[model samples]
Target chain A: MLSKKQARAFFLGGTLVTFLIFIGLTIFSLSKDVDQTNHENITEAVVRGKDLWDHNNCMGCHTLLGEGGYYAPELTKVIDRRGRPYIKAVLMSKVPWQPNGRKMVAYGFTNEQAEDLIAFFDWIDDIDLNGFDRVVSPLAKDKTN
Target chain B: MTLYKGKRRTTTALVLSMGLFFAALLYLPGMLPFDSQVTDSFFRWWVVHLWVEGVWELIMGGILSFLLIKLTGVDREVIEKWLYVIVGLTFLSGVLGTGHHYYYIGVNKIWLIVGGIFSALEPLAFLAMALFAVNMYRKGEKKHPNKLALYWTLGAAIVSFVGAGLLGFAHTLPQTNLYTHGTLVTAMHGHLAFWGAYAMIVLAIISYAMPNMTGRKLYDTGRGRMAFWFSNVGMVGMTVAFGVAGVAQVYMERIMKIEFMKVQEMMEIHFYILIICATLFTTGILMYIADFIKHGQPTDEALIKE
Candidate 1:
């Protein structure tokens, strides 16, 4: 029979070891067969699209997967939802505001900016969130996670 | 035991509420993806704001308050005052910031401006608290010896303010927000603010408090430092990569008028940086866990309180 102190040690050590193993296994499993592809650099056109996006601060208005200052629609699946042509057309509409009665206001994007914005949106679409939770940014202009 | 038990219960309750709220916000949106009306999106924002800047921040404050009280032995009054101000402002600005999100949700342009300005105050408030915390840590370090927790506390403040407050505010200006709305730069903010400001603090508290609670000093100073470096560097790398990629994506999609799909294919180049960062972050988390586990072999003296 074990002493009380030894028994306590045994329990704590056992629990800690088990937890470490679990974590290790999870990490290993996720890393195995990982895509191992890199996506940090892109062409000048994409970079230009990003510059235009930043110059305008589109995220302040729209959200991606529920993040960003809330003031825009959730654009995580925007590509999936609106497709490319509709998205581009909407952008080029040059209608900055929705007048008075429309449910959604139109932010005017330059023809070039509209294209870049769509490219940016498309870039995010390929990410595999793997069913992660979508949480919006309160500061995101008009967004839902 | 009574004092400890009461505080633990409170902490547990706060943690439970946060978990519940996270679940609600994360899960409920998927149920109505097809019903992508503006109103539906608004409902999502309500949860996002309430949790991120609202109750979670308050919970974080309480945790910080507890850490400050323990580490500095400061009077509860001062700490509580900090809590009141931080939490109070968070709630105030947070709720009002909902107006900014309302602009797209079938609301008027006037509200966009209102929400824009009000939400801008959120980062400033965070910045103020961060400065106060860092100042306190600095003062304490100069005056005291047993101020180990202060380092992490200072780190939490600096990163929270710089990464979350400053970077976040950079693009929040109404004019600037017009284009960067859903880009990777936004992703950069989310990663840093949530992990740096919120997660790091919470993790630091756990690192500091667990030893006291468990009557074990298994975590080593060296390992703690290693974890900090790893996590911090990883976070920065991830943010920068995502931010740049976000810019690239925006340029491709918005300016080039390229099909969004084509733009995404182009943006894949940044995946390497993101992957590396994620690996580093995971390594950091692992190191932290190792520190917790190996914080083994309690010191001989006072392993148990009399």
Candidate 2:
């Protein structure tokens, strides 16, 4: 029952407003939850490590910032799960490092390269990811939720 | 007549797109309990899964229905009937199919059952669209002069079936998604679905409407055909590259348990291929835009008289 002009105006305006609000609200909520308090230790080594990770395209096989390939486990908390020395050793060796049944691809990282990536991993570990795997079901006796 | 069609379809699509977007907005605040990454993840999937899989389909349905009615020279009632079927199938499955993203998002274990079963039915809607478009094209006795529009319309329906339906079903089961959810495998499906279902329909509408709007008949030009073929072939090439890289990534990283970065290093060649294909796709879009500009501004006198 609306005129064409009115309809067009309402349609475009409504969509634009809705999209803007959705994005704004999501960003606001995400900002409140960001826990990057570990910024002090984000040195040049960590930056280089991040650069090297992007350069080699590690995300093609691993998850980082929850945005990459999920073939391998998430590297967001990898440093915590596996110690720095363990990660370094795994990188330095060229053999297929089998974390499970799958043989891990070896990239032949030198000690320095390994240390830099480990440092990047170390820096990432300090940020709070809010416990991605903590059980929160009502059925659990001590529900984290 | 053309102005009426553009405003009507644009208005309808905009309304539908906003409706779902707003629904997701209302649903998002409750998901803000950032203490549990599990909780954050549970709600994050709601917005993404609901938009792409749910309401966006309605937008595509509206545009496709309009295009079919115009391009096929079919009676509006006939096209509207099939439109109803498409909308019905889409909502019936798509609303519940959102459960597909629920598996392992820290929701209740009930999701494992519901998500798997419902998502299995999702491809039916896309298949219906493919059949519907092809049938309409066949039934229309008179050939529409705009061959490029016809090509894109048919391409939208058929390719969407392969990308959003068959390719989507390739790894949609809970069992497969458990392994392929965030991997490059998902990327392959995502790229094709967006291109085929959404992007193609957009191009189809533009192709159909542009000449009519500007009082120009440029459909037979080689550039128009080149744009269509180049973009379509480029997109298919990109999908294949993503697919090949994804399969190898799953094997190397998940099955072979290669260190993640090493597997990525091995797969860098595929990314190069993706870039090259993307460039080709961009070039085709630029060519299409060039034709669009050459058509000149629309004047009221330019409107075609029946």
Report model 2's TM-score to 2 decimal places: 0.67
Looking at the true structure's interface, with contacts defined as alpha carbon pairs within 8 Å between chains A and B, what fraction does model 1 recover? 0.02
Model 1 spans with C-alpha error above 4 angstroms: A1-145, B1-36, B141-148, B218-220, B296-306
For residues A76-109, write the lDDT of model 1, one tens digit per residue. 6576556788887766665654422223446566
* lDDT tens readout by residue for model 2, B9-110: 543354345545656564664555433333445466666776666567767877887788777878766666565566556656665566666554434444
Best by lDDT: 2
Cα lDDT of model 2 by residue, A1-145, tens digit:
4344553454345435544553453343334343233545668887778777877888777765444665566766576556778888888888888765556777889888899899887766555433322211111112334
True contacts kept of each: 0.02, 0.07
Model 1 lDDT tens row, B1-306: 443466355432443355455546655643443122233344566567656766666566666666666666665555555555565566556555655544333323454565677678778658766866765554443343323355566677778777767777776665555555555667778888888668888786876776766675434477677787898898889988888887886576545545444555676768787999989988888888887776633555636452
